[model samples]
Target: MRNFIFILTKEIRSYFYSPVAFVVITIFSVLIGYYFYNIFAAFSTISFQAQTDPMVASQYGVLNVTEFVIRPFFGVVSIVMLIMLPMLTMRSFAEEKKTGTIELLLTYPVKDLELVLGKFAGCMGIFAIMLSLSVPCLLLVAFFGDPEWGVIVTGYGGLFLMGGAFISLGLFMSSLTENQIIAAVLSFASLMVLYMVGSSSGFVGEKMGQFLEYVSILSHFETFARGVLDTSDITYYLLFAVFFLFLSMHSLESKRWRA
Candidate 1:
């Protein structure tokens, strides 16, 4: 436990020492803020149109401000995460390998799983901080409109879990290559595959479609976005994260023999 903490602390410091973490954070905050502004503008436009037209007013009468704004905001944030997380995670193990420091680190008393978990925790910690930067937007929503707090809570929970899965996959990808760009590209490709697989259900037969949706990370996120909070979705994310983490540990173990 002590060793793990030391490693985690080191990894966290590394993130701050480099410009990558700061860059990613800045880009994410700006984009999310812009996204919220767009949503708010669209909502305002809709409200204005409704006031001018009785038909439009009746059609939009059932639109809850909270649901109309917050849900789509969450959806777009999820998409932003899908794009930004790879940049955040690309250098985890790749940099070590590139600098030939991985060999030195492996000689330490630390176990492979400890190293993986320490690094994983460090990345997640950074991501959580980035996610917190969006809080002011949510607060704005709460102040101007009665956003559904329950839905907001569940959506954040889903985002965090989905991020864990992305980090785990990115870590494994980083372990496979010495070039950080290659690592980032591979991670993005892998994530895209997992993401796009969800759409396959629409093209395939019913039985296979259900299976595709079940396997797709986005499908589980949909339930959370709707405030459903099903155990199956929770379990899927847990297992997805664990599976990739285990693969990362195995990948690191292979480095020992290949060294």
Candidate 2:
């Protein structure tokens, strides 16, 4: 546990020591803020129209803040995360390998699982910070409109889990390459595939479609976006993260054997 904390802190510090953390955070904040402004603006316009015109209200039905604003905001945030998280994880193991520090890191009195967990935790810490950017947006919505707190809570929870899954896969990809760019590219490509895999489900047969939908990371998230906290979705994300983290540990183990 102590070693895990040490490694976790060290990884976090390393992120700050470089420009990567700052750059990613700045870009993330700008992107999320832009989306939030646009989404909220549209929602506000529609809401005003509905309130002023009974006809508009009747035509559009009830204007749900959760459905019109918060949900779509979270969805856009997820897409932004898909694009930006790779930059965070690209250097995790890749930089170590590139600088020949993997040997020194391995010699430390830490188990492979601990090392992996510590790194995962560190990345998650940064991810949590990134996700916090949404809080003010949510608060703004709450102040101006009645939004479903349950959906907001589950939406962030789902994002955190999805981010863990992305980071774990990015860690595995980083372990496979010494070049950070390659690691980032690999992570992006893999995540894109997982995100879009469900789209192909419609073209396939029923069984295959079911399988594809189940495999898609986005599909599981949709339930959370809708405020449906299904155990199956939670389990899928947990298993997704664990599977990749296990692979990352295995990758390190292989490197240890080779060393």
Q: Each candidate's TM vs. the true structure?
A: 0.96, 0.97
Task: Please list the C-alpha lDDT of all candidates, in the order they appear.
Answer: 0.89, 0.92
* For model 1, the run of ten residues with the poorest summed lDDT: 59-68
Task: State model 1's lDDT.
Answer: 0.89
Instruction: Tell me how far candidate 2 lies from the true structure as C-alpha RMSD in angstroms.
Output: 1.2
Q: Global CA lDDT of candidate 2, please?
A: 0.92
TM-score of 1: 0.96
| Model 2 ranges with Cα > 4 A deviation | none
Clashes of each: 0, 0
Model 2, range 49-101, lDDT digits (tens) per residue? 99899998998797888999988888998999999999999999999999999
At residue 9, give the lDDT of candidate 1: 94
